[model samples]
Target: DTSAFIMELPAYHLPYAMTVLKYALDRAFSFVKRAGTIIFAMNVLIWFTSNYNWTLAHVDASQSILADVGKVVAVIFAPLGFGEWRATV
Candidate 1:
Protein backbone atom coordinates (compact mmCIF):
# COMPACT_ATOMS: atom_id res chain seq x y z
CA ASP A 1 0.00 0.00 0.00
CA THR A 2 2.81 2.46 0.80
CA SER A 3 4.59 1.67 -2.45
CA ALA A 4 1.30 1.97 -4.34
CA PHE A 5 0.75 5.44 -2.97
CA ILE A 6 4.26 6.45 -3.84
CA MET A 7 3.89 5.14 -7.37
CA GLU A 8 0.63 6.95 -7.87
CA LEU A 9 1.88 10.35 -6.71
CA PRO A 10 1.44 13.11 -9.33
CA ALA A 11 4.23 14.05 -11.75
CA TYR A 12 4.90 17.27 -9.84
CA HIS A 13 5.57 15.26 -6.69
CA LEU A 14 8.15 13.12 -8.44
CA PRO A 15 10.69 15.92 -8.47
CA TYR A 16 10.00 16.72 -4.81
CA ALA A 17 10.33 13.11 -3.82
CA MET A 18 13.49 12.78 -5.84
CA THR A 19 15.02 15.82 -4.18
CA VAL A 20 14.03 14.62 -0.75
CA LEU A 21 15.38 11.19 -1.46
CA LYS A 22 18.59 12.68 -2.79
CA TYR A 23 19.03 14.74 0.36
CA ALA A 24 18.23 11.77 2.57
CA LEU A 25 20.61 9.56 0.61
CA ASP A 26 23.34 12.15 0.82
CA ARG A 27 22.93 12.39 4.58
CA ALA A 28 22.85 8.62 4.96
CA PHE A 29 25.99 8.27 2.87
CA SER A 30 27.80 10.83 5.02
CA PHE A 31 26.84 8.82 8.09
CA VAL A 32 28.11 5.62 6.48
CA LYS A 33 31.40 7.29 5.62
CA ARG A 34 31.86 8.52 9.18
CA ALA A 35 30.93 5.15 10.61
CA GLY A 36 33.36 3.46 8.25
CA THR A 37 36.13 5.78 9.37
CA ILE A 38 35.45 4.97 13.02
CA ILE A 39 35.31 1.25 12.35
CA PHE A 40 38.55 1.36 10.42
CA ALA A 41 40.27 3.29 13.20
CA MET A 42 39.00 0.87 15.85
CA ASN A 43 40.02 -2.19 13.84
CA VAL A 44 43.53 -0.90 13.24
CA LEU A 45 43.93 0.18 16.84
CA ILE A 46 42.55 -3.06 18.22
CA TRP A 47 44.71 -5.14 15.91
CA PHE A 48 47.82 -3.19 16.79
CA THR A 49 47.07 -3.40 20.49
CA SER A 50 46.15 -7.09 20.54
CA ASN A 51 49.08 -8.22 18.42
CA TYR A 52 51.79 -6.36 20.31
CA ASN A 53 52.54 -6.27 24.05
CA TRP A 54 54.18 -3.31 25.76
CA THR A 55 57.82 -2.91 24.58
CA LEU A 56 56.36 -4.03 21.20
CA ALA A 57 56.80 -7.78 21.86
CA HIS A 58 54.44 -10.76 21.72
CA VAL A 59 52.65 -11.69 24.98
CA ASP A 60 49.47 -13.24 26.42
CA ALA A 61 46.06 -12.35 24.97
CA SER A 62 44.26 -11.21 28.13
CA GLN A 63 46.92 -8.60 28.94
CA SER A 64 46.75 -7.36 25.35
CA ILE A 65 46.48 -3.76 24.09
CA LEU A 66 42.78 -3.69 23.36
CA ALA A 67 41.94 -4.53 26.95
CA ASP A 68 43.33 -1.26 28.27
CA VAL A 69 41.63 0.80 25.58
CA GLY A 70 38.39 -1.10 25.91
CA LYS A 71 38.40 -0.60 29.65
CA VAL A 72 38.80 3.15 29.22
CA VAL A 73 36.00 3.28 26.66
CA ALA A 74 33.82 1.11 28.87
CA VAL A 75 34.22 3.55 31.73
CA ILE A 76 33.41 6.46 29.44
CA PHE A 77 30.19 4.78 28.39
CA ALA A 78 29.33 3.74 31.92
CA PRO A 79 27.67 7.08 32.65
CA LEU A 80 25.39 6.42 29.71
CA GLY A 81 24.05 3.37 31.61
CA PHE A 82 25.93 0.75 29.54
CA GLY A 83 29.05 0.03 31.58
CA GLU A 84 29.91 -3.37 30.11
CA TRP A 85 32.61 -3.19 27.44
CA ARG A 86 32.49 -6.91 26.63
CA ALA A 87 29.43 -6.56 24.41
CA THR A 88 30.53 -3.18 23.04
CA VAL A 89 33.88 -4.31 21.75
Candidate 2:
Protein backbone atom coordinates (compact mmCIF):
# COMPACT_ATOMS: atom_id res chain seq x y z
CA ASP A 1 0.00 0.00 0.00
CA THR A 2 1.07 3.58 -0.62
CA SER A 3 -0.09 6.88 0.74
CA ALA A 4 0.65 10.54 0.17
CA PHE A 5 0.06 13.43 2.56
CA ILE A 6 0.20 17.22 2.28
CA MET A 7 0.52 19.74 5.09
CA GLU A 8 0.80 23.49 5.49
CA LEU A 9 3.78 24.71 7.50
CA PRO A 10 4.73 27.92 9.30
CA ALA A 11 8.09 29.52 8.65
CA TYR A 12 10.66 28.53 11.33
CA HIS A 13 12.20 30.99 13.73
CA LEU A 14 14.51 30.57 16.77
CA PRO A 15 12.61 30.02 19.96
CA TYR A 16 13.01 32.45 22.88
CA ALA A 17 15.62 31.24 25.38
CA MET A 18 13.32 31.72 28.39
CA THR A 19 10.50 29.87 26.66
CA VAL A 20 12.77 26.94 25.86
CA LEU A 21 14.13 26.88 29.40
CA LYS A 22 10.66 26.97 30.91
CA TYR A 23 9.43 24.16 28.65
CA ALA A 24 12.46 22.01 29.53
CA LEU A 25 12.02 22.63 33.26
CA ASP A 26 8.33 21.81 33.08
CA ARG A 27 9.05 18.50 31.35
CA ALA A 28 11.86 17.69 33.78
CA PHE A 29 9.69 18.35 36.80
CA SER A 30 6.86 16.26 35.35
CA PHE A 31 9.23 13.34 34.77
CA VAL A 32 10.70 13.68 38.26
CA LYS A 33 7.25 13.67 39.84
CA ARG A 34 6.22 10.50 38.03
CA ALA A 35 9.53 8.75 38.71
CA GLY A 36 9.51 9.77 42.38
CA THR A 37 5.99 8.44 42.88
CA ILE A 38 6.85 5.11 41.30
CA ILE A 39 10.04 4.76 43.35
CA PHE A 40 8.20 5.66 46.55
CA ALA A 41 5.49 3.10 45.85
CA MET A 42 8.02 0.39 45.05
CA ASN A 43 9.94 1.14 48.23
CA VAL A 44 6.78 0.88 50.27
CA LEU A 45 5.86 -2.41 48.63
CA ILE A 46 9.35 -3.83 49.21
CA TRP A 47 9.26 -2.72 52.83
CA PHE A 48 5.85 -4.24 53.41
CA THR A 49 6.65 -7.49 51.68
CA SER A 50 9.98 -7.92 53.45
CA ASN A 51 8.68 -7.08 56.91
CA TYR A 52 5.32 -8.84 57.10
CA ASN A 53 4.27 -12.45 56.95
CA TRP A 54 1.31 -13.81 54.98
CA THR A 55 -0.77 -13.46 58.15
CA LEU A 56 0.23 -9.79 58.30
CA ALA A 57 2.15 -10.16 61.51
CA HIS A 58 5.44 -8.32 61.68
CA VAL A 59 8.25 -10.73 61.02
CA ASP A 60 11.93 -11.01 60.21
CA ALA A 61 12.91 -10.71 56.55
CA SER A 62 13.81 -14.36 56.35
CA GLN A 63 10.33 -15.35 57.49
CA SER A 64 8.32 -12.80 55.54
CA ILE A 65 6.07 -13.42 52.56
CA LEU A 66 8.76 -11.96 50.34
CA ALA A 67 11.10 -14.73 51.40
CA ASP A 68 8.57 -17.43 50.56
CA VAL A 69 7.94 -15.96 47.16
CA GLY A 70 11.64 -15.47 46.62
CA LYS A 71 12.31 -19.10 47.45
CA VAL A 72 9.99 -20.17 44.67
CA VAL A 73 11.71 -17.79 42.28
CA ALA A 74 15.09 -18.95 43.46
CA VAL A 75 14.27 -22.46 42.32
CA ILE A 76 13.54 -21.16 38.88
CA PHE A 77 16.85 -19.31 38.85
CA ALA A 78 18.89 -22.12 40.37
CA PRO A 79 20.08 -23.49 37.04
CA LEU A 80 21.13 -20.02 36.02
CA GLY A 81 23.07 -19.56 39.27
CA PHE A 82 22.33 -17.23 42.22
CA GLY A 83 19.59 -19.47 43.57
CA GLU A 84 19.50 -18.14 47.11
CA TRP A 85 16.16 -16.68 48.18
CA ARG A 86 17.82 -13.48 49.37
CA ALA A 87 19.63 -13.12 46.08
CA THR A 88 16.47 -13.86 44.13
CA VAL A 89 14.69 -11.19 46.01
Candidate 3:
Protein backbone atom coordinates (compact mmCIF):
# COMPACT_ATOMS: atom_id res chain seq x y z
CA ASP A 1 0.00 0.00 0.00
CA THR A 2 1.15 3.58 -0.78
CA SER A 3 -0.02 6.94 0.37
CA ALA A 4 0.52 10.37 -1.19
CA PHE A 5 0.37 13.66 0.63
CA ILE A 6 0.61 17.20 -0.80
CA MET A 7 1.06 20.39 1.17
CA GLU A 8 0.72 24.04 0.14
CA LEU A 9 2.30 26.95 2.00
CA PRO A 10 1.77 30.71 1.82
CA ALA A 11 4.68 33.08 1.26
CA TYR A 12 6.39 34.24 4.47
CA HIS A 13 6.05 37.91 5.36
CA LEU A 14 6.79 40.05 8.40
CA PRO A 15 3.68 41.24 10.23
CA TYR A 16 3.10 44.97 10.86
CA ALA A 17 4.32 45.65 14.40
CA MET A 18 1.54 48.07 15.35
CA THR A 19 -1.14 45.81 13.96
CA VAL A 20 0.27 42.83 15.86
CA LEU A 21 0.49 44.82 19.06
CA LYS A 22 -3.08 46.08 18.70
CA TYR A 23 -4.35 42.58 17.97
CA ALA A 24 -2.51 41.14 20.99
CA LEU A 25 -3.82 43.90 23.26
CA ASP A 26 -7.36 43.41 22.01
CA ARG A 27 -7.22 39.64 22.59
CA ALA A 28 -5.64 40.05 26.01
CA PHE A 29 -8.30 42.51 27.08
CA SER A 30 -11.04 40.20 25.82
CA PHE A 31 -9.58 37.24 27.74
CA VAL A 32 -9.18 39.33 30.88
CA LYS A 33 -12.75 40.56 30.69
CA ARG A 34 -14.12 37.05 30.34
CA ALA A 35 -11.86 35.66 33.05
CA GLY A 36 -12.73 38.48 35.44
CA THR A 37 -16.43 37.87 34.97
CA ILE A 38 -16.09 34.13 35.55
CA ILE A 39 -13.84 34.64 38.55
CA PHE A 40 -16.29 37.09 40.08
CA ALA A 41 -19.14 34.65 39.63
CA MET A 42 -17.14 31.79 41.15
CA ASN A 43 -16.19 33.92 44.15
CA VAL A 44 -19.82 34.73 44.72
CA LEU A 45 -20.78 31.07 44.48
CA ILE A 46 -18.01 30.00 46.86
CA TRP A 47 -18.99 32.72 49.32
CA PHE A 48 -22.63 31.67 49.19
CA THR A 49 -21.91 27.97 49.57
CA SER A 50 -19.32 28.39 52.28
CA ASN A 51 -21.47 30.67 54.42
CA TYR A 52 -24.96 29.20 54.06
CA ASN A 53 -26.55 25.95 55.14
CA TRP A 54 -29.16 23.87 53.37
CA THR A 55 -31.83 25.95 55.11
CA LEU A 56 -30.18 29.10 53.69
CA ALA A 57 -29.32 30.38 57.14
CA HIS A 58 -25.83 31.77 57.57
CA VAL A 59 -23.51 29.34 59.31
CA ASP A 60 -19.88 28.78 60.15
CA ALA A 61 -17.63 27.75 57.23
CA SER A 62 -16.99 24.36 58.82
CA GLN A 63 -20.73 23.67 59.01
CA SER A 64 -21.76 24.99 55.61
CA ILE A 65 -22.86 23.04 52.51
CA LEU A 66 -19.45 23.40 50.91
CA ALA A 67 -17.81 21.82 53.92
CA ASP A 68 -20.22 18.92 53.92
CA VAL A 69 -19.59 18.21 50.24
CA GLY A 70 -15.86 18.70 50.66
CA LYS A 71 -15.69 16.20 53.51
CA VAL A 72 -17.42 13.58 51.42
CA VAL A 73 -15.08 14.17 48.51
CA ALA A 74 -12.09 14.20 50.81
CA VAL A 75 -12.79 10.61 51.84
CA ILE A 76 -12.96 9.50 48.22
CA PHE A 77 -9.63 11.16 47.42
CA ALA A 78 -7.78 10.13 50.59
CA PRO A 79 -5.82 7.27 49.04
CA LEU A 80 -4.70 9.42 46.16
CA GLY A 81 -2.89 11.95 48.37
CA PHE A 82 -3.84 14.89 50.55
CA GLY A 83 -7.58 14.64 51.09
CA GLU A 84 -8.31 17.17 53.78
CA TRP A 85 -11.74 18.74 53.45
CA ARG A 86 -10.20 22.18 53.17
CA ALA A 87 -7.93 20.97 50.40
CA THR A 88 -10.73 19.19 48.63
CA VAL A 89 -12.78 22.34 48.51
In angstroms, give how far residue 69 of model 2 lies from its true place. Answer: 0.7
Taking all chains together, each candidate's TM-score versus the true structure is 0.53, 0.83, 0.78
Worst 10 residues of 2 by lDDT: 1-10
lDDT of 2 by residue, 1-89 (tens): 23356566899999999999999999999999999999999999999999999999999999998999999999999998968999998
Number of the predicted model whose TM-score against the real structure is largest = 2
lDDT of 1 by residue, 1-89 (tens): 56655645455634578889999999999999999999999989878887777778776655666666667788878887767655445
Question: In lDDT terms, how accurate is model 3?
Answer: 0.93
What's model 2's lDDT at 27?
Answer: 100
Provide the overall lDDT of each model, using Cα atoms, as 2-decimal numbers.
0.76, 0.95, 0.93
Whichever of 1 and 2 has more lDDT, that candidate is 2
Cα RMSD (Å) per model?
A: 10.6, 5.3, 5.4
Clashes of 1: 0
Best-to-worst TM-score order: 2, 3, 1
Each candidate's clash count: 0, 0, 0
